[model samples]
Target chain A: MLQYSEKVLELFTNPKNVGTMDGDDPHVGTGVIGSPECGDVMQLQILVDDQGVIQDAKFKTFGCGSAIASSSLATEWLKGKTLDEAMAIQNVHLAEELELPPVKKHCSVLAEDAIKAAIEDFQKKLEGRTDKAELHSPRCCEKLNDCEGCGSHGE
Target chain B: MKLPIYMDYNATTPVDPRVFEAMKPWFCEDFGNAASRSHVFGWKAETAVAESRETIANLLGASPQEIVFTSGATESDNLAIKGICEMYAPDGGHIITCMTEHKAVLDTCKYLETKGYEVTYLKPDTEGRVSAQQVADEIREDTVLVTLMLANNETGAVHPIAEIGKVVREYRARLHSHLFFHTDATQGISKIPFNVNEMAVDLLSFSSHKMYGPKGIGALYVRRRDPRVRLAIQTHGGGHERNMRSGTLNTPSIVGFAKACELAAAEMENNVAKLRHLRDHLEQGILQNVDYVKRNGHKTERLCNTANLSFGYIEGESLMLKLRDIAVSSGSACTSASLEPSFVLRAMDVPDILAHSSLRFSLGCYNDLAEIDYVVEKVATAVRELRELSPLYDMALRDNTTGDTDWAQAD
Candidate 1:
């Protein structure tokens, strides 16, 4: 058996914030990372408030005990943090905190990737909403009528 | 019942108490080098060693002169493969083996390849079986040796060695060439019926630890009649074991190994029946309670005490961690230093996902029905719990598929 720290074992046995959020919700961001072929796949989701603070976080992982513990601890650390603060959390921090050996360092790397991907998804969602709003606005309509380069609107 | 149940007997078995008792005198009271032939102590040790050799030889249906003791099965395999290759280098330089063979044999063949020897590694079918026809087809004029295993360690799939042996013998006679057959019977020695004569095996390798004996002792059976097998000595010093293996005999472990063989031969039938019943109960319970579980290996031709299963949508190491009270092994890459699943499972064409989810439960003589029952309950519960936490399981439930994600997109 791999020597795991007490904290890692505790989190793995009774992980915090483990579930799925509505990916369709504009306030919810979903990040899926890793591959099943490699024996690890993690899906992390976060519910962000209007002020861009993470109100809730959840994760589901199919991997080793260290991967599960890494993602579980990632969710616990993500709750109530700002998107920037969550981005600041690196894999080394998780590896150090979990006392993971070198062989299990990839699990922490996956956790970090999941955190970044969720933040990117949330940012992309905000940008997509802005674009949609601008497309339906009177100003965008006026610009569309004047611009011949807007081929879809001209047709 | 013990809190942590042992079900990984394929890895290694606990030494039997009776075998230990038989070996205790040799460790202290009869401590003398068997080669020191001038004294009473040497004579006593030599006599004990000869008796142990006779017992081991009897179990394998061979004479005492044919058995050559070594450190363990690994050393025996190296000796048989490399020894034969070097001895017959003048006649031929080709060998045939399976991809699912143990590393001891596979790596030795690989090392031979570096020395300009040609080796044909045949792939096994989905049930981890290679046919005799395949062996016959691969035999070339230059093929001097055909080495395959009696049973796979990971999946417990028994190969048809007798048929392969017949094919090799036929080719040897028809072509009037020097062709030999060997089998590493470490896993199948005591669990199944095996006779060197019936199998037509020229060289056979087996270990004591896998059969409830002390570790650090094993033997290789070299045929001395019909078609006498000559092997170039791999170890050269002091001329021990008839100038094949050159090391002082481990008297205590050899005695323990002989006792283990005697006990296994006596109680094999009853033990096999009981182990089969317990193994089937465990397999059935898990199959009935869990979804998306696939049993690996040949369904009917497998070892009675082995059950290799792949539970979908859950990683094997995660499940093993959850089922900590039950000792078992997994094919998952996460369990090893390498990032690949068991090569034996891969050779059998098990997909990467399923291979990562595989577990091997090997029962032993000491395990009881009640322990199997506990394991079943624990496994079912742990699988259910892990599935709940697995995103892949959720995806499977949503789409009604096997949760197989395209690797190109999953990245």
Candidate 2:
């Protein structure tokens, strides 16, 4: 058996922010990374507020203790962070904090991927809403000053 | 029951107290070299070694002279395969083995391949069994050796050694050529019925640690009559083990091993009965309590003490983490350094996902019904908890509700 660190074991045994968020919720963006073929899969979801701050973070992972701990730590770190701050969370930080062995570095990478995927999904949803609002009512884009990057601000 | 219950007997078993007691005196008092012919201490050590050899031979239904002591099963396997291959290189250059064999056999066969020896790796069936016909058909005139394990270490799948032995014998007779049969019976020694004569095995390897004996000692039973099996000396020193294997014997461990064998011989029937009962209860309890679970290996042909289960949706390593107090093995890539699940399970055509989800619970003599009950409850609860934390489980459930159970097919 592998010797797991106390922190890794603790996080694995009592992972924070476990369970799922409504993937269909507009305020929620879900990121699913890794694959069962590789013997790990992580799903991380972030609920963003109107001001682009992460209101809540939840995750579910099917992998080793390291993988579970990585994602659990990711969720705990993701809550209350802006999308940019969430994106800045690298796998190295998780690896260092968890003191994962070299063989388990991929678990931290999976956690990082899950975070990026969640943020991208949230941005994509926001873009979709902006596009729909623009198509329906051009004035709605004006009312929402966040349409600068929507590529039709001047038009 | 202990807080951390040991259910990974297939990995290695704790030495029995009786066996330990039998070995205590040899470590210090009778520490004289068995090869010394002049001293009384030497005579005493030699006598003890001889007695242990006789006991071990009696258990295997072989002559005491046929047993060759080695460090452990790995060395025995190395000696059996490499020794046979090197000794009979001129006679034939072909060998046969299964894909699911332990690394000792498989890697040895691979080494032979590098030396231009042709090795036929027969594929096992879905249940992890290589049939006797498969062996017969693969038998070539130049097939010098056929090495198949008696039972797989991972799934506890028992191969039909006697039937395969019969096939090898018939083929050798038909071809009128030199052919030898070897079996790594490490996992099957005391757990199942095995006899060198009845199985028609020319060479057999087994370890003591696997059978509640001391570690670092094992034996190889080389057939001495009917068709005397000859092996090239792998280790050359002091001309020990009748020159087949040359090294000073591990007297204390050998004594412990023999005592373990004696105990196993006496208590095998009752022990097997109790182990089977406990193992069956554990298997059934987990199966009934947990959904999306499947048992690996042949239902009837597997070792009675081994239960290999694949709990879907939850990865094995994660589930194992939850059941911290329950010591078991998993076929998860994360558990291994190579990032691949058990090759034994893979050879049996288990899906990668299910292989990642596999857990092997091997019961032993020390385990009791109460321990079994605790393990079963713990496993059930752990699996349920892990599944709840598995996104795949959530997706699977959603897919089931929608009557589109093909979500797993996406991967």
Candidate 3:
């Protein structure tokens, strides 16, 4: 019943780089954001180099087709781009590229938020603020295996 | 089978060719108002109307005079609820209805609440069942009407309407109050056969489109013998429909509706058997192959055609998109285009995340084993694809494998 552009359908049907990277690697910073209740959950990972340029980007989302397409497009746009250029990528560009209706615009926003959160995680890793992992638990903020933040309640 | 095999029969059904054939003459050669009782054209039309009325009445196990046509289930529901309230609650009284009723019944009861009527909205169980005991507990001396749905549109869970009706009858006798029982049987009319007499029901409402009939026609069965129900006429035109409703008959649609009922009366058992088989095959296939899947209603007491499943960690809208070739609906597909989780599931206490991921596949008479197999394959593929991209699914897997993801210490 939704009017999906060919590009959106293409990316969603065959989304690229849709898996988790080395969450423990300092070069690989992962950002997980979005609410599962809203039908938008995006986890974007990026491998950054000393030059602050993204070498690779990957994403996995549990949301609508537009959200999957949006994050997939975000990953495609993230690689080889500097942090500043990646940050410059607005939700409007994603929405326009996907030809999404107004109702689906939030999906692009979630992608943008995932990008910002990943960049923040990458920067935090570079600065060696590992203690801040406490802020995000039950999710891979820093550690992928044993989550100290979620240590008490059995997940 | 055609692509996008329709599985939302609970929404609406295709008009059967037989029903269409029966209606075609009414639209052309037989185009005469039943109210025009002065000529041959009128007599012919009146005869056709009478024959159709008998057919519908026979299907409902009622008399021809008991059947009253309306625009659709919505109008029938409105007339029943408001008319009963007007006749019995002139000075004001209490009404009872459940939370998971179709909007036609719920909204009408809600409007009564605004007009100085005390309404008690009963909550169904987690399996989406409104128990007769719940209705009995809510009954009081002032309770004038009890309106509940026979089957939930979203969950397809069949409530014990007969028992609930008996409860209302008992309370009415005890209190000597004018408490009447009404049920919206739009989803369960022919799908699961029941007679108003055995149920002790005063009013029953159902739609034509839901049973392979035309879209704009429906009927309400009003009891005429035991206690005899009366309504304050909402329309006052030509005093048609025994002065209960006033409007020119929609001859074509009415004939179509009756033909559908006749066909259903003959073949419903076979269709239901086939539907149950197909539905169970689909449900079992998905549950066996997929993980974190939960059925959304009572297993045995549901419409044989419906299967509502919640796939954990998968967004419903996204799942529906991947299933474009299969005509199914997400739980929240009805209202608000923003993809909110189904309120029906929420009322049943389903977690919001699971509710967001739920899909409702309502099978119909036309669907066959081949279509069910195709649906199972496509749905399995779609769910697998979406879950592969779901970080929640990945995280849950990791947590389970590690036997650790306990974030309770943070609290």
Candidate 4:
């Protein structure tokens, strides 16, 4: 039998936030990774604020106990961090938190990747809004005095 | 400490107390090489060896002259399969076997295939069983042998060897009638009846370790009058076992094996009945307490002491780790590498999710009702908890039928 770390076993025996949630929420960023062929799958969701800070996170995993525990622990850790903070979270830090065995380090790595991936999605969407605002600036419409009242500038 | 339950009877068995007693003297004061002629040492060794051979032959219903001893069932299987192939290679050159045969037979067949012998591997259906008619259908004019396991190691599904043998005999009436029938009876010896003539097998393999005897020893039964069956000698040191297998016999282990066979023969009916009762009780308890559990193998044709289950949505390795107090095996103990599920289950077309969740509980001589009950409780709790945490379970529970929830679909 594989000897699990105390924290991994604890989380495995009593996993936290282990169910599906609404990933389409305005505040939530979703990250889904791993294939069924690989024998491990995880779906992570993070609730973040307008200020790019994470308020809460949850996950559902289809894998061995180590993978399940890693996702559970990863979600709990990401709940109070800023998006950048979550982005900076390393797989090693998650592994250490769970004391994961070397063989199961991949599970922790998956957890970290899912975190970074979700945060990056939020950052990308934030950047898209800024780029759209800049493209429609009033300074660029100086010659068009009635541009404010004109919802459609051209037919 | 509580005695850890021994459910790995297929791996090896505890030496029976009586067999151990019979073997004690041969290890010490009476030790001598049976082949050393013209001395008290030789006489004593010869007497012990001959008596042991007679005891074993009686159990198999064969003359002592037909039994050839080897290191174990592995060597016995090798000597039977390869030896026959080598003897008739240039003239006859073909063999037939099932995919579910033990490594001893399968590997030997593989080696033979590489050495220019054509081997046709028959695949069993989803139930892990093959029809005798299938064997008859596959037989060709060039085929020299038909070998199948008397009972499968993982599923414990018994093959219709006697029927298959009868078909082979009818089809190959003459032409050297070079067709030989061999069954690896290692798993079937004590649990099921094995009459060589009744089974119509020309060659049969039996091992001691699987039947409450010492390891590193076993025997092969050959019909002395059969001109169609003879092995090309592989080992040639001192020409022992009528020049078939050549090694100085370990008297103590063989003696223990013989005694174990005698005891098994005597207690066959009683033990089979008791083990079946205990086995069914364990199965019933799990079925009563756990949902989405499935039994593997043929319900009626399976070994009396064996049962395998697939705990839907739970990994077998996790369940095994949780139930550390009890020892058990997954399907194909050798082939089922860690977390890989089982090849046998895969061949049966069992879905990968459920295959990975399979567990085997094999009962033995020492297990009783108390042990069975305790195992049932631990397994139920562990499987239930494991299933509750599985996302696959949540998806499966929705339909109440466990349809493949895009589980096997690769992304």
- On lDDT, the candidate that comes out on top is 1
Clashing pairs in 1: none
DockQ for each candidate?
A: 0.28, 0.30, 0.33, 0.10
* TM-score against native, each model: 0.93, 0.92, 0.93, 0.86
B1-411: candidate 3 lDDT, tens digit per residue = 888689999999999999998899988798999989799898988998899999999988899999999998999999999999899888778989988888888888878888999999899898999899999999988888999988988889999988998888888888998999999999998799888888889999999999999999999999998769998788789899999888999999999999999999999999999999999988887877776787899988999999999887788888888888888877742124534467789889887777888899999988988998888888888888888888888877877732322111100
Minimum summed lDDT over a 10-residue window in model 4 chain B is located at B331-340
Which of 1 and 4 is ahead in DockQ?
Answer: 1
- lDDT per residue as tens, model 1, B242-325: 899999999999999999999999999999999899988888888777768877898888899999999889999988999888
For B1-411, candidate 4 gives per-residue lDDT tens digits of: 255887878778899899999899988888988988889987898888999899898887888988999988888888888888777665448899988888789889988887888998888887778889899888887888889998888878888888997877776685545778888999999999878877778888999989999888999998776433689887888999998888888889988999999999999999999999999888888888776776777778889988878777666666776677898876421123233456666767777666767788888989989998999899999987776666557656766766543221101
* DockQ measured for candidate 3: 0.33
Q: Rank the candidates by DockQ, best first.
A: 3, 2, 1, 4
| Candidate ranking (lDDT, best to worst) | 1, 2, 3, 4
lDDT digits (tens) for residues A56-120 of candidate 2: 99999888899899999999999999988999999889999999876677778778878988888
| Real interface contacts reproduced by model 2, as a fraction | 0.69
Candidate 3 Cα errors over 4 Å, as ranges:
A131-155, B332-338, B401-411
What are the per-residue Cα lDDT tens digits for candidate 2 across B1-411?
Answer: 678999999999999999999999998788988998999988988999999999999999999999999998999999999898889885439999999998999999998898889999999998899999999988888899999999898888999999999998888788887799999999999988788989999999999999999999999999998688899888988899899888787899999999999988888898889988898888877766776777889877989899898888888888888887889999977677556778888888898888998899999988988998888788888988898788888877776642422211100
State the TM-score for model 2. 0.92
- In candidate 2, list every pair of residues with a backbone clash: none
Task: Superpose all Cα atoms of candidate 2 onto the true structure and report the RMSD in Å to 1 decimal.
Answer: 8.8
Question: Candidate 4: what lDDT?
Answer: 0.76
- Chain A TM-score values, per prediction: 0.82, 0.82, 0.83, 0.77
Interface RMSD of 4: 18.2
For all candidates in order, state the fraction of native interface contacts they contain: 0.64, 0.69, 0.63, 0.19
Question: What does the i-RMS of model 1 come to?
Answer: 15.0
